[model samples]
Target: MRFIIQRDHLVQSVQDVMKAVTSRTTIPILTGIKMVVSDEGVTLTGSDSDVSIESFIPKEEDDKEIVDIKQTGAIVLQAKFFSEMVKKLPSDTVEIEVQNHLQTVIRSGNSEFNLIGLDADEYPHLPQVEEENIFKIPTDLLKAMIRQTSFAVSTSETRPILTGVNWKIENNELNCIATDSHRLALRKAKVEIDSAAHYNVVIPGKSLNELSKILADNNELIDIVITENQILFKAKHLLFFSRLLEGNYPDTSRLIPTESKTDVVLQTKEFLQAIDRASLLAREGRNNVVKLSTLEDKIVEISSNTPEVGKVVEEIKALSVEGEELKISFSAKYMMDALKALEGTEIKVSFTGAMRPFIIQPINDDSILQLILPVRTY
Candidate 1:
């Protein structure tokens, strides 16, 4: 394989694909990146058995040459070394040539290195997904959905299904939900779908997080295709594939409370900041717990106390406080996560009781909902 590519484009492609490559894989070839040079462009692929990412650099784009293909061939190089080498190369262009017996030579301005390459045939093939059920979503909205819910995925390995965010599509609406038993995040958005096909799939939170980073924050539409076991996201010049989690995600619809005994409307920023200050003291104790209690005249008190550490108390005036007065204790970390995810100025918080799960959501928007189970404080 032989090719000459622009240095900046090569570095960006390498970094993007490297996100899928891991050194801890059982297959040694999985640690390497496969490069294929064709008449149209140069393609780079990275995989770790669970996820795969491919980037394409066209030979010429907009009458400007990005890659000058010398020969049509394929080669696999050590991703860790090759990626690092390309980043530090002091040249506007880079040349790669594969010699006999898989000896690869990389050259740039005044610098040259030889790396032993593996046969690209040994690399595992990526899953082939059909475009029958393809759907489109705006890139910025997709990123927001991931950020709003991925944090609630369970980190424990005991229940693998809970480690992924559940995706359900029905009636032109897509709903994403994630929960770690203690807290839950839900985000819903309207989409355009031709077929009446409803899909209920759970995608690994780690995969969504990586995909969010790979996708640019723009108004471009992203094409998504789902197969039986794999999901493919097609962006401009990039293709990402992630394996779906195997087990059935637990039904979380019943977990949300249907009634509220106490409700308060306040500014999201202020509530988040108050909890942030109280968490300092809570962090010194066993559990990062903070307490909230409603007072007369629409005043809400946020406080945290630790025997070894000091106590913090802050009061904020709510827009309106209704229902029965309530006092609840919950993890400060959980509250802060929800508040940050909401990303709204005005928020409404509802408490069913002192011990039941409470809900937080934007005052006028019904699309996003956050629920946190109160912690037991003795």
Candidate 2:
């Protein structure tokens, strides 16, 4: 295989695919990235069984040439060394060639290096997903959904399903939910589809996080296809595939409280900053717990005390406080996370009781919601 590609283009494509390549893999060939050069363009694929990413660099885009292929062939090269070489190449273009014995040579400007290559045939084939069940969503909105929920996924691997985010689609709406038994983050958005379909899939939070980072903030639409065990995300010239977890996600609909004893509306930033300062002391405690109580005339007190450390007490006036007055203790870290995920300036926090789970959501938006389980501080 032989190809001549621009330095910047190759570097970007390599970085995108590198997210899927793992340094430690049971299969030896999984550590290498497969490169295929055809008449149309050059394709680079990286996979580690659980996730796969492919990037295509067309010969000409917008009537400009991006790659000049000298021969049509394929080869696999060590991902780490090849990526580093492309990034450090001191030239506008890079030339790659592979010999009969799988020896790969890369040259750019005055630098040239030889790397041991593996046969592309030994690499595992990516899952083939049919486009029959496909939908489209804006890249930025998808990234937002991932960011809002992926952080809440359980880090413990005892129950593998909890380590993934649940994705459900029904009636043209895409819902993403993640929980670690202590808290939950949910986000919903409208999608473009031809026919209605209901899907329940659990995707690894780590994979979604990587996908979010790779997605550009442009207005381009991404095509999503779901199969029985795999999900595919396609952008302009990139394809991302992930294997679905093989277990039923726990039903979380009943976990949200239906009633509220106390409700307070406050600026998101104000509450976040208050909790940030209060947590400084709470973090030193065993549970990182902070107490919030409603006072007369709509004043909310944020306080935390540690016997070995100092105490912090602050009062922030709420936009409006309704229902009965209540005091609750919860993890300051959880509260800060929920606050940061909120998009609106004003947020409404609803509490059913001192010990029940409370919800934090935007004042007027019903699409996004966050729930945190209050910590018991006796």
Highest lDDT, which number?
1
Clashes of 1: 0
Instruction: Give all TM-scores, in the order shown.
Output: 0.98, 0.98
Our model 1 lands, by Cα RMSD against the true structure, at 0.9
Pairs that collide in candidate 1 are none
User: What tens digits encode model 2's per-residue C-alpha lDDT throughout 1-378?
Assistant: 788988889999999999999999999999999999999999999999999999999999899889998998989999998888888899999999997759888999999898989999888999988889789999998988998899999999998999999999988889999999999999999999765698999999999998998999987999999889999999999999999999999999999888898999999999999999998987877888999999998999999999888999989999999998899999999999999988999999999999899999999898999999998888
What are the per-residue Cα lDDT tens digits for candidate 1 across 1-378?
Answer: 788999999999999999999999999999999998899998999999899999999999899999998988999999999999999999999999999959999999999999999999998999988899888999999999999999999999989999999999999889999999999999999887865978999999999999998888798999988888999999999999999999888899999998898899999999899999988989989899999999998999999989877899999999999999888999999999999999779999999998899999999898999999999886
RMSD of each: 0.9, 0.9
Judge candidate 1 against the unseen true structure and give its global Cα lDDT, from 0 to 1. 0.93
